[model samples]
Target: MSFVLLVTLTVIEIVLLVLVLAIMVTMVTRQLRSIAANLARVAFGVRAVETQVSAIGPGVTEVNRLLRDINGTLPRVAQRAEQLAR
Candidate 1:
């Protein structure tokens, strides 16, 4: 009698433990899927940024060249202005 009751209780406990483990596994699977989707979106966004930067590369170089030209002429313009003031 007591032995049968003990065996039955042990079986119930094992079943409950298995149920709990299954629920945890299901929740973990869902969270992993969510993380994978977010990572994919981040990857796509990074690719778009790379494309835009590459497209702007030539314009950036042109602007830098124009700035250098302006910088070179500024000193001569300042000297001319000084002469005019004198």
Candidate 2:
């Protein structure tokens, strides 16, 4: 009788362990799905930012070229000012 009781308890323990493992796996799967959804949102935002930056690139280059032209004329303007002062 004691042997039979021991066997029954062992089977119950195994069944409980299996249930615990299944619950843990389910929780992990839910968290992974949540992470995947958030990552997709982040990717979309990054693409939008990239598009805005690309649109600005040509304007920035034009501004830089204009500034360079202004800088080239400054030295001659300074020389003319010195001559006038004399």
Candidate 3:
């Protein structure tokens, strides 16, 4: 082949290779972005669960307080009933 033809072929080959690499890079970047978005959504869901679980402590505390109040009143009622029986 003539030197000029060989040089032209080489240039075309280089350009094609560069284009393919660019396309592959863009595809990979797109996939990475999608994965990052999914991970963010998962993180948000986890945070919501954490907030719900954290609230359970105070809820349980309120229930315990209500039970204690009810228990305290029962003893007084029992003592009054015994006195009446005497």
**Each candidate: how many clashes?**
0, 0, 0
TM-score, predicted candidate 2 vs. hidden true structure: 0.67
What C-alpha RMSD separates each model from the true structure?
A: 3.1, 3.7, 8.2
In candidate 1 the C-alpha lDDT for residue 44 amounts to 100
For residues 1-86, what per-residue lDDT tens digits would candidate 1 score against the true structure?
Answer: 69999999999999999999999999999999999999999999999999889989899999999999999999999999999999
Task: For model 2, state the Cα shift of residue 70 in Å.
Answer: 7.2
lDDT of 3 by residue, 9-74 (tens): 999999999999999999999999999999999999999999889979888999999999999899
TM-score-based ranking: 1, 2, 3
Query: After superposing candidate 1, which stretches have Cα over 4 Å from the reference?
Result: 61-86
How well does each candidate superpose onto the true structure, as a TM-score? 0.68, 0.67, 0.64
lDDT of 2: 0.98
The lDDT values for all models are 0.98, 0.98, 0.97
Clashes of 2: 0
lDDT at 73, model 3: 100
